[model samples]
Target: MGSINYDDSDVLDVLIVGAGISGINAAYRLHDELPDKKYLILENREQLGGTWDLFKYPGIRSDSDLHTFGYAFKEWTGADIAGGAEILAYLKKVAEDNGIAERIRYKSKVEAADWSTEERCWFVTVNQDGEQKNYRARFLYTCTGYYDYNKVLHAEIPGIKNFKGKVVHPQFWDLKEDDYRGKRVAVIGSGATAITLIPSMANVTKDITLVQRSPTYILSLEKYDPIAKVIRAILPKRMAAFVIRQKNIARIYASFHIFRTFPGVAKAILGRLTKSQLPSDIPLDPHFKPNYNPWDQRLCICPDGDFYTTLREGKAHIATGHIDQVTSNEIILKNGERIPCDIIVTATGLKLSVGGHIKTTVDKKTVDPSERFVWKGSMIEGLPNYALSIGYTNASWTLGSDCTAQYVVRLIKHMDKYHKSSVVPKPSNRDQLTQRPLLDLNSTYVKKAEKDLPKAATSGPWRMRTNYWYDLVQAKYGGYDDLVFA
Candidate 1:
């Protein structure tokens, strides 16, 4: 879509970056809740639906259920786990249905934003259609996501350059019509991506070998939610959806609590469930069991036990070992085992691209976002009229995004009511509080870019954790006293 002139409101009240799942939610909330307030979404890519549009690999589906993965305002009518294309379609539908499409400027990559203290506004620069365009807004909100937009940080294996076979990262699966028919594929890493890729590639390839340093917890998910489907058939569309959504979200959190509170019980429950699904031939000691507790890393889900089923069919294999090096057509394990393959799929993980590489300057000075403390995992300290739409690690992502968007709207309305121009979260006792990682995710992706990420205060308004239930009330309706308004 061509960039609009934005005649109605050239100077928007808010400027949202990234048109992904988080951006779509933010836009819908902004449109319906704050009708009078003008806003526009600046997406770097040529289309909306950030993650969904980007990841086109086979079997690219949501790990989190659509009931919670979907926005609070919008209902996901698909299965519990949806494919990448379907998710993208859902995001686009949300934007189109909510009148957010027109306000989105595709290919409008925001390179830098300068905060003018005198005007109490932000001047944003976007690279659109090979031209640098400027726009001003009262507030700036980012749903750019935590991962690097440019590329996924694939693990750098030694002697990979010497390997003759094609190496590809899931972030940029360039060939749309890629066919691995009769080809031997070796996938590296044991995260969600690898789990999804193994079963998917196995269908088309002769053999698929998943090589990993360690195994991660991969659970089996029901293909559909029968209760929700039954509830929808009986109750009003929206009412049933709301009820089902709330119930599902609660179950997710409760499960998480159980895992944390009673690790042994949780392990046994998960272990038994996994063992029941796996074929008797496959061992559960190392393949299914992870040394870490559940949720230490984001638990991967195989819809209808597809991954295990693939293994049961003898179409796929999981090899847990350290990589010594890669020769022309094989991966030599450090333990002196060599796996032959024609393709190496690196599901290493993603890097944190905080704020989508958009440079932010406060009062002509560059704002080092990493140095500032994050307040409630949504907004950064010392940054006025700005918030980040980071989703939950323990639960579905949209849970946090949906509530955080509402909270942002509430904050904006409060500002308007009091005739205030800016709102910022100021630390109560910065020096006294201990700093912690911005996210508790132990995944390689979150850990890779720890240094560049913002810090959280140990105990204060500046503290943030991944709790959907806590955030629903605390983030959405929490006290505004922690914020400084001017």
Candidate 2:
């Protein structure tokens, strides 16, 4: 990676926070569209890949396929369900190929960003290597993910401290420190992490049990896409990638629409598919059934039905009930059942964070995101020249973030063409607009952070939709009626 010295007085065209998928996408777009612009990406971690680098648990992999998850400029010729390491390698390759690696500064955490209307710039404070540094930029773009990297949702299991065996959270799983070989393990929660871990550790552990208060929709997906393979074989690399990516996007859009429009029919179809994969002894009503319809919350995906295969092989087990208490060597259920194990893996969930918890101020007055509205799902209302790179919940995160990047690039081009220094969203009748949660999901993590996150209006530019097709068109041709350019 290339390093450069920057004086505090030097102002950049754009300052992007977080070197994850969204941040990388933004940097690539800026280089491709506005090569003359000076931009830098500040990553909090020492490595480039954010989530892919932080997570090191067994069976760490993408829940979404690479075709849709990967950027439009890049071609993902790997398996549909890729491991964490493979994903990280792809990100590194993208950065290296596009000369984005040199623009990234590691171990630089943004603490606060204050906007100055008089100067028409953002004064950013960063914590770098235990020392404070300052940077100035014309525009600020935040790609920090929605979750808190330093903290995990606390598991409220009673008497968890009494457990004599080693307790571990999947978020902070230490492979070398915590060994489950030939030892019984009790995996808590039924989210994506728990499902992935149960099947992955099933063979190594004496036995693994998945304990959940409620079940989540678990679907078995193919690891490799046959259609993608055929397209790649017939067409050129770029052409094949475009075709495969579009096909997957359409498929996911249609699937989500069908699930929401005809929930009863969708539920029946999902129920049958799940039942067919599981053994007869493991009933579909309690163990596999979810109270909410599909797509209500993010579905837990099991590549190649590995989770079901483990259950059928008697290597993995499931318990659906509230935890009464954790004993020295057993997890007792409220129904008076005992699950004995040597280790407890709390795969509860993640705590939601917005803007990487960076403090924002406009002229020294604190700006609360929860009170502000999101404009075009990219810029926060009343925030000048600031863009947020957030992704889709129903589809691959890259698709939504890419749309945001495209929109920001377009906005920047418009500003430069008209000799405008800054632009901020100002809805005329904000008080009359109906407010909604920015994130559409009803997931536990989202619900917990609803009041802390930015708001979405019921209609107009302030509304945020998870639809990629609509957002893509808006990004390319949407009008800036609500924006005030200065």
Best-fitting candidate, scored by TM-score: 2
Residue range 250-278, candidate 1, lDDT tens digits: 88888888898998998899899888878
Residue lDDT tens for model 2, 58-112? 9999999999998899999899999999999999999999889988989999999
The Cα RMSD in angstroms, rounded to one decimal, for candidate 2 relative to the true structure is 1.7
Residue pairs clashing in model 1 are none
Q: Root-mean-square deviation of each candidate, in angstroms?
A: 2.3, 1.7
Q: Which regions of candidate 2 deviate over 4 angstroms?
A: 1-9
Judge candidate 2 against the unseen true structure and give its global Cα lDDT, from 0 to 1.
0.91
TM-score of each: 0.96, 0.97
Worst 10 residues of 1 by lDDT: 1-10
lDDT (Cα, 0-100) at 240 in candidate 1: 87
Residue pairs with backbone atoms closer than 3 Å in model 2 (clashes): none
State each model's CA lDDT, in order. 0.85, 0.91
